[model samples]
Target: MQTTDPQGSVPSDVPEPPPHADEPRKLEARLTDADRVYRAVVSSGAAATLLLITLIGVFLLIGAWPALKEAGFSFLTEKVWTPDGQPPRFGVAAMMFGTFVSAVVAMAITVPVAVCTSLFINEYAPRAVRRSLTSLVDLMAAIPSLIFAIWGLFFLVPALAPIEDWVVAQFGGWLPLAEASATGGSLFNAGLIVACMTIPITTSIIREVLAQAPRHECEGALALGGTRWGMITSVVLPFGKGGIIGGSMLGLGRALGETLAATLILSIAFEIKPRILENGGITVASGIAIEFRDAKEMGLSALMAAGLALFIVTFAINFLAAMVVSRSRSGAST
Candidate 1:
């Protein structure tokens, strides 16, 4: 008989070994050529922005070099500005002081109103009302600076004169701004005008940024039984701090470069006074705008130097804003 196995199973060829437990892991590839090109393009665009800023600085410096070399460092500290006589003495102290004081006054006036308006829009107003009000603010922003100057000169100045007189009567003895407005135009007037000019921009930007704050963070604050003010102060502000700073800086930049409005409203005298309502002070931009028509040769160069100084200040403010934004982003990521 054939001796066949009871279980007539076919024999297996072999058993495969299991995958190794300690094999080196492979990583996904980083990027393709197209992706690299795209990244390079983006980087180049960013570099181009910096390059443009550098070029502007270089151009400004080149244009102002004659005055800069002639005046040396004393140009910054000197208070008198002649610009017409022989050798044409030009000092930036009065202009610089005027610029800073007007800007400060504008910021002081703008910050409170802008912040409050933004808060009301974000937290208090109905959706319909908020939309309408926001549109109005945007419209205000579209109004030309020259128009604002005209309004300030023709309308606001007259309207504010009585108020100015009241202020002078109230504090004239203690402060110089109250020393009587010889022509009804003062640094205070310019500052108030600038405040009006900056309000729409600051309020709109701040409202938009505050609106972008993390909803969940605000909700969490509410859930913790926090009042609306408490939630805003603790959560919303901290979250939107960077944007607030950016908006303020943007307003400051506007204030620094404002020419027509301040020039129209300010007295443009060379006298530098500590009083906000003083009549004699003038800003760099206003100085340039007012005198550029008459300026020639050395006078033109000196005015350009003033312009360069304003440019540097505005650039520095914007740079600080960028750095703040970057740091805020980094902190958020962590």
Candidate 2:
């Protein structure tokens, strides 16, 4: 029976009917076994990812041991990469330089174009055309890198030769990387190919992220009498900064490891060149691709060492990119 107040009426604050009989049991189930099991499963997946990365590092280190032992510390500092000589002297100084320059060039060209393309699809395109533009960018990412390599080697190089020559003739002396060969297969040319390969993927990634920007923020900006460009500058750009950074870095990784494009186009010089367009620089991936076919024993080990260095560099870069993405997702900026 229900309790009553001073009179015969039921108490003003009636009990809440003792919650449903099954509610407490359901609540307990969620807080105990179910929650713990879900947490453990997610944690294990993350741990597995880290373990795989560690195993890869260990394997590369072991594979590279022979060259390291033979060359000592000089393997890193020395510029020579002649692995077939008697007593075999080798180093990756040149490949490292080429890797840096080519990847930098690729990122510089790819990032701006990708950002603009993504913004166009996400912010400015007609609604009917948005899907089509996005699909076009997605299609480009699926094109084989081999196709890009072949096109760059035969058609693209020859077509761009005249323009490259003019740049070399006019600014080669004053600008650091303005030098291009008559054939147009310089470090810059290879970088351009890599940029083309990267842009589609980068644009796709950025457009996807920008699509997630809060709708209210966008509408509010326009309602405040902001122009389209003003809305982008004040609202969309800030909102998608993390997506932009993450996509660009992923594109950088592609540029770093591009093999056939660089190998087929570069003159494969053994030293750093200030002029980006001059004949040949040997990037790590291209070096491995070119020499792996003929490498034997010690030569093989030396190539493994170069490959390992590339792995380390790419790993560090990706790790930093992940951190930046994290900051962006958490709404932090600095």
Candidate 3:
């Protein structure tokens, strides 16, 4: 039975609930003066960066307007870039083709080597040697583009000429791509140089992503009697798939924009050449660099138009890469 208190209310053993049981706890951070200042500074910096990018795009558009107005849709379709001719019959089709082909070739070479190097460095190397290897890759990334161009022109081209000739001779009959002359200044050699330039940055990004793969998942795979290669295949590779794509796209963008190396290594041709092994091809960036020095009024505008095209392509590539990364497991911040 229940007992009554002095006021005749029934009493039980249960204690009264605390004052506001249903009210949610406030989780908001208390901002200090320093915190507020830091937030404001960071916000301004981000805004500034966006604004700067917008300004650059606006400038490119303004500068390219005259050429685009004159050339109309033909700017993209026509291959001949005789800007010096009356009415300026210029277009980016051939240069764009060369850019894509060389970039594709570079990616084909870069991706495998980068993945293997990253995996070996992250999963197989001794901890003592890992840092050194990583630093070496970073150093390679820091090397100037001009130096790579000079090296390709003087040494790499000569070294690759014999190999190029042999490959062409072996496969030329069966493969149209291999039917062209295997000269020193071909897109093939330029692609090789671009591949070397791309490898370091790609390896660095992939290595970091692979290193971030869930440790427990990897161990679980190994515990399930999986071999090292099997564990990596099942765990690390899946986790880093987005990063690999992102790195490859980034490398492709770099290859497309690489001016000095392409300019130095390629003998520029205005016509579309599907055969990358040929001695002459021109990328958009290389064309711009080569033509800029002697360009007059309309020619300069035409070059700006070309620059606009390249800028759009690179911007799209990077934006796509960012989207892929943001949707990937490795991109999660916490």
| Candidate of highest lDDT | 3
Encode model 3's per-residue lDDT on 1-334: one tens digit a residue.
Answer: 4678899864867454457767785555559999999999999999999999889889989999999999999999988887877868999998888888888888999999999999999989999999999999989989988888899899988888888888889888889888776577888888889988999898888888789889999999999999999999998998888889888887888998988888999998887866778799899999999999988888899999999999998998888788877787463543
Candidate 1 weakest lDDT stretch, 10 residues: 9-18
TM-score of 1: 0.84
How does each model score on TM-score? Answer: 0.84, 0.85, 0.88
Stronger candidate by lDDT (1 vs 3)? 3
lDDT of model 2 at position 320: 98
- Which stretch of 10 consecutive residues in model 3 shows the poorest summed lDDT? 9-18
Question: For candidate 1, lDDT tens digit of each residue in 36-113?
Answer: 999999999999999998998888899899988888998898777776668678888989888988888888988888
The local lDDT score (0 to 100) that residue 112 gets in candidate 1 is: 82
Top candidate, metric TM-score: 3
Global lDDT scores for all candidate models: 0.83, 0.85, 0.87
Question: Residue 180 of model 2: what lDDT?
Answer: 54
Ranking by TM-score: 3, 2, 1
Question: Would you list the clashing residue pairs of candidate 2?
Answer: 267-280
Location of the lowest summed lDDT over 10 successive residues in candidate 2: 22-31
Please estimate how well model 2 matches the true structure, expressed as its whole-model Cα lDDT: 0.85
